[model samples]
Target: MEKKLKKLKTDNARKQIKKNQNIFNIWTKLLRISAIWIRFFQWRKWHKDHTYPKPQVGPLMVAEIQQAKERWITITQRQAFPEEINSLRNNQQVVRGPLRTLSPYLDNDLLRVGGRLENSNISANRKHPVILPRQHVVTEMIYREYHQRYMHVGPQGLLAAIREEFWVLRGRDVARATVHNCLKCFRARPSSLQPAMGQLPSARVTPSRAFAQTGVDFAGPLVVKLGLRKSTTTKAYVAVFVCLATKAIHLEAVSALSTAAFMAALKRFMSRRGKPSHIWSDNGTNFVGARKELECCFKKQLTGRTVPEELVEEGVQWVFTPPSAPHFGGIWEAAVKSFKHHFVRVAGAAILNFEELSTLLAQIEACLNSRPMTALSSDPADLQALTPGHFLIGTPVLMPPEADYSEMPDNRLKRWELVQKITQMFWKRWRLEYLSSLQSKAKWLNPTANVKIGTLAVLKEDNVPPLQWKMVRIIEIHPGKDGIVRVVTVRTASGQQLKRPTVKICPLPMGKEE
Candidate 1:
């Protein structure tokens, strides 16, 4: 009996070995037909004289196992709908589940939708797409793959494309999350942060002497004739000085944009209107140079044993807004706009000599200063609406004479008392009319989340598309007094550093936390 059992086991082992050898031969032949090469010696070792070695695992078996491992959708479906699959196979009706209403059924061991469109002539995949769980990893991969395949479309479009072959549970929510997480989609249509509007600077709201706190800006490269007889022309720019307190403007024409030219214009401005205590301007090249020169002058005077009193008295503090931020110097920018509006109409296409241009600028300045600072009153008894010129010279620069208060009784008012009273009245009106108007924000009413250090962002550029905007990494943030981040310092991909306002920086969806 023992001898018979041993013989039977040997026969079974031989039969198993022969089956594996035949499968290996078929795989080798297929590889050869597909132009894949195997060493002749290796082939000979295995198949010499039509005799095979002991059977081992083959490439076909390994490949089949790998393919089965990759079918994550099947594994998930089996885990989620084992009862539904079993019931369908046994021809039993599905009782209660998310898929009960869909009338799901098994096709090739995979669950699919069995909706009313079974009789439609459309493709099988479209009529009954594979149902997937919304929160599963496989479903996310499929959503992302189809999203990119269709050119990173919006949530609805991505869902529509996915439903042609897949019916993801809560597909709209999944599609939205996928698109929101896509780096390319976020960068293509990025959103910039808009913090709440900041408080007005003290220089702008406080009452002071005209031109005491001033902002300066350049207006144009206006064409002016160099000589009347020769018709030779050159470019001339207007230097606009605006009072931060009163909004009165003074215009000076410069032959060129240079340190010396700007200094000369500054001297002219001070000669007409007294030297300002503080001057604010954008960081133009000329302004930067002027600031450096002033610093050097101060250093030299301090080093000397006997400093000149005139130099010390003439010292002016210059303030510059961040580079490339024109909005920071909006007071002077608005003044430049007012200058252009009048200059364009007065000068037109006619090119005038330097003297004529200067005269025209002076006339425009007078007109701008005379504009009403407050709304005009319909009642005739009310005093004329206050103007910037009123703060400067106690009346409109272009207005006609009014009834004389000089002849009033001594008890009513003296000359000095009348002057003081009129000055106080002007300031009181300015506080009630001009300063109160700034309380309401015109835009950016709501604050957004502040960008932190190490966040990725896109630097906005004029005349450039959003896709072409440079990627940047935030290295620093400059928050306002209200603790809202309005500006940030960033390093670009090329390693260049730039300071930009939050309005010009489009932050990516994912930050350092991700």
Candidate 2:
């Protein structure tokens, strides 16, 4: 029985390998065809706009054209393209000009259009009709002949190169179609512009206290000396908390990424910045593990851990963005980048102890958080850049202070009302200056149609040939709230499914639906 099972497994493995080989062969064939088309297009383009050495049409080329014309005429008499011939005849009658006259001509018992024959009177002139067959084979042959001479120009240029000696009926359209389907051309094409920006989340649009709705992310594995020894090296991580509403940032230094270290960092953040109503973080293992432990504490699973009970009851929610989707947490991610940029320069070539590193991190955090929230005014009289500090402390960090209201009479307003007035003023400026800045899109200007389910696509791989490109069919579309498909689920020939962003997928050209 065991022997039979082993034989069955071997058979399945062989079948799988054969299937993969077959798929590879199909892709190879497609790419080969695409290469031919690309070369033809390249030759055509250069021959049109650029000037090059005129190619001499030998007797062999002339004889080949003559043979192709004869073949086409034979086919035409046999009624292979009776409709096309009849249409041409009708067109010749309706037109009255040199072009109309040129549409009908006889050469060596075969009907030809365009190009005058060379004679002794015009020995310098090389213009002549090089008749071509109706089949794709003859057209490609003509393209290759001129392509080698013109050094692979595109469609328009190639047509110009051939026009000096030959004219094929509807050659322009045929050349264009071939160029459009070229794999080489497609690979070299620029990336398509992205769709319009999606709407801002409520956290960004709403006005709230600093750190009320926050995004948390970690940065760094900076080297810090342990104890007093210069050789004892330890890694330290920084937990960065960014306020979604006010863009205020808070930094915490942790020794490790364990649950205990994160919890300690979170406690310090809550103590100084106040408890966050909602915490948004990426799907990191540490973050996820922390959430699970917090849940256990919230559910009273651990004995004597009752301090977080009230905080849980009051709705301290932790939300995680999708796995592998870092763009979802771009706000905090940007903060992390700014932090790393400055920290790297400040701590250059020095390995500081934990206490020293902690102080430097705090200083860097303050510098980043004080950066302008909106564009600076150019006028000298209008001082003070609008920054996150304005929302947190009611003024810019380095700018001169305004008139103090702290010493005002007690009868003027209650303590809560005074705070409310200041907050309201900050919000008013935030709406006027910050909100307006969000209107312009910095990238991805053009909108494209959404990729539909069941559409065939090729996965683009860098430094890899098109024949090796993984082929798949769209199984599902994951559209954003803006009704644009950004991500999709695809199924391969091996029956495996994968989730990929639209940028990585290259849809195959197909006919329009009827």
Candidate 3:
């Protein structure tokens, strides 16, 4: 009987491994396809612009003529784009970068648009059709995602690199901005730009690397009174560092809310977990603006853009998001939410002190990390039951659950050296294989166009049936170069389509009044 049970368990384990491998295969294929498209887009940036090179300057001022015969520039080649780019071509800005990633729908469309080196990630995302904003993330995160996708340039250089890459893919006029904004280009100043160096991170680099990309944040100044004396009160702070890939966390409670206190907590983590690559947080005055502005009239004139900073030099990079926006740092936000539940409800409505709370945090983290997660939905037994630690670090640690940790590769390398090497190596290999898979899956080329200008389109959805309406004017059309659109709609009354990036257009309605 015992042998039978053991055999069943072994069989289940083997089955689980196979299931994980299948998911990995599909995900990697997506990455490979995306990578090739990016490589092609990088090639054609140097091609020249069509139509009399420079804009024709005369009394005629015929925009229609310019729009009709204009040519599209290869974003990578730094050439010219087609004039039919958009109706607002005259006012459009021609910031250049490579177009990376092709649309899945169209066989030949580039997914990302590009601009000049001077343009920031925010600028490029706004200009291109492919790099749209995600639902839960802030705009900065959107930029971060774009840089990760291309792996060609940093946030600042995305605009330029995108254009260069794009030209290689199609060598066509991208959107309307280049032609409209060319005249305005003279106002721009010149400066040297740094290109992106490291390979992109592999589909999240899960594994012990889970604890590598951590986000640390302080949850509160919990005013809890404890100890034998009734007057004795404790001021405490929760310092949490969560692995990005694994979602496993190392949490603690400290006595005070000072920079000094935070440093002590960090040191504790390093002693055990080792140094992390990135530490995300909210720009608290303690962790951020320690230095006062140097009030020198002469020195102040030297540079206008400066933010106050109080850096922690523990051989780790500290990334801070905007104040009051906790969601910007994903791990920390989740940690706090989980901690609050325990602190307020589970651990008794009673308040906790620095020491007691810290003890509680350790317990909570263990439970959260050990439990398998449902997200790795690919596994049948625990595919859904995989734990957060498994998610971040990757399954089947060097030392499985039964054994202690046998090796620590990070310890041999200096913190920063480890960071750079790991980021470069993992990102390089992952980008190649995984990106190809992304390309195969995200079919953007033959997008289904829903509505057109002058056509009366109906609002369609399941729950909001009555919310639907009749004919309305089609004011605008959001069309990618491939012709298919993401959304189509009318103005007023029973209308649908909440804030999506691309939309179709149709003809205006004839009557409005009853």
Candidate 4:
């Protein structure tokens, strides 16, 4: 009985295996048939839609073109010129529509202009072009097609080309808009936004201690001899510090462009001109690194209670302008220019030693500080005009000593009181003269619309062609105290974010949906 059972089990297992194999074969065959059908259908679709090498214009093709144009014109006219169409159908004049001046009439169910040029010896299409409403999609399509056919010509040329076939309403305005919206034209002639000049910062307009609020910048890699030998030479740089309130400048010579060198220069400046409450500079790598180091030092001193009370009270506050924006630090930039002007004229290709360079810079600083800040008076008896030197010392750095007033009995003659009175007088003149002069904007006199987030723009790069400039999308804006946006943060196509002034961003024309 056991042997008979074993034989039956083996037969049943073999039958089950055979049944599973048959099911697998059936599925594989079905998959192959489906794939073959898919390829066959794709080929059929390609064959049906493919264009012939030399396609003949048959009656069917002509009929299809006529039908499409009629459909498009019917939809467009009904949406835009329904009243005019009704007036024309009733044999009345179009008195109130935009087409009233054009004297439009229907011919073969299509609108055409009834202009005085009807008798001109030209083609029918040119003599009385088909009238199109400007706001409709059909009009846009026709304008775009003609604009492209003319190889992206100017507005006047584009308008003339379109008038050869269609007389679009407000054709000039439409043509201008179409040209403005072209990506290629915009990329070739990208114009940056010109927001109105911003209000002067408090540091610039208000009177303060000389060098209290400072703007710092680096000048150059001036060639300098290492020693008396002319062959042994090394590169050096000038650190220019300008007082925002007084326009006084301090120059320091540094050996290299590094954070350590900058720190040393800063120490020298503070030791001589006093520690500044705020320091403004461009986004140079050395400046950024020094700021970080200073922050770390300040934190440690505060935590350990090692900093003196006076030092803590006079803490340094560093502010950085947006990257690649030199205009933001115009004060120091101007000073650097003045310094170079003097240095170039005086030094004149002469490679001096480091000490000689330092001395020359000091003399130039004195000359700059002694310059008249306000216009000179015509009256010869009037006291010398206020200068940056007045805020630094008691008088101009280059002026001769005045007659001693120690013997005078006036209360202002007292040493401390006289000094205070002199300082007050200087500030009064600054407020009335220098500050007022800054009220008038040098350029960018008109206000424009602010750029919005998600708008596409091109970044203006120095020494780069407009076509090669990177494309960016505005993501954020930085408005001033008066609520004018001058700075914005943008993201590039490579996912890099940059903070740039609006003057460096050229926004592109937006579509209706955008």
lDDT of each: 0.81, 0.69, 0.45, 0.84
Pitting candidate 1 against candidate 4, the one with the higher lDDT is 4
**Superior candidate under lDDT, 1 versus 2:** 1
TM-score of every model versus the real structure: 0.78, 0.67, 0.34, 0.80
For 315-370, candidate 3 gives per-residue lDDT tens digits of 35666554444434544787778777766765775676556676777777776676
Clashes in model 4: which pairs?
A: none
Q: Count the clashes in each prediction.
A: 0, 17, 102, 0
TM-score ranking, best first: 4, 1, 2, 3
RMSD of each: 8.9, 14.7, 30.6, 15.4
Give the per-residue lDDT of model 2 (tens digit) for 145-217: 5654565567898777766655556678656654544444444552332455567789988988889999999
lDDT by residue for model 1 (276-333), tens? 9999999899999989987787877877736787767678999888876798888899
Q: Which residue runs does candidate 2 get wrong by more than 4 Å?
A: 1-180, 183-193, 256-264, 283-285, 288-297, 300-305, 314-325, 380-383, 397-415, 459-470, 492-496, 511-514
Lowest-scoring 10 consecutive residues by lDDT in candidate 4? Answer: 21-30
**What is the C-alpha lDDT profile of model 4 across 19-103, one tens digit per residue?**
4332422322323333343344445646766752333232334444454455446545766888888889999988996888888
lDDT of 2: 0.69
Task: Name the runs in model 1 displaced over 4 angstroms.
Answer: 1-70, 76-111, 114-116, 303-314, 377-382, 402-413, 463-465, 511-514
Count backbone clashes in candidate 4. 0
Q: In model 1, how large is the Cα lDDT of residue 265?
A: 96
Reference-based lDDT, residue 443, model 3: 24
**Candidate 3: what lDDT?**
0.45
lDDT ranking, high to low: 4, 1, 2, 3
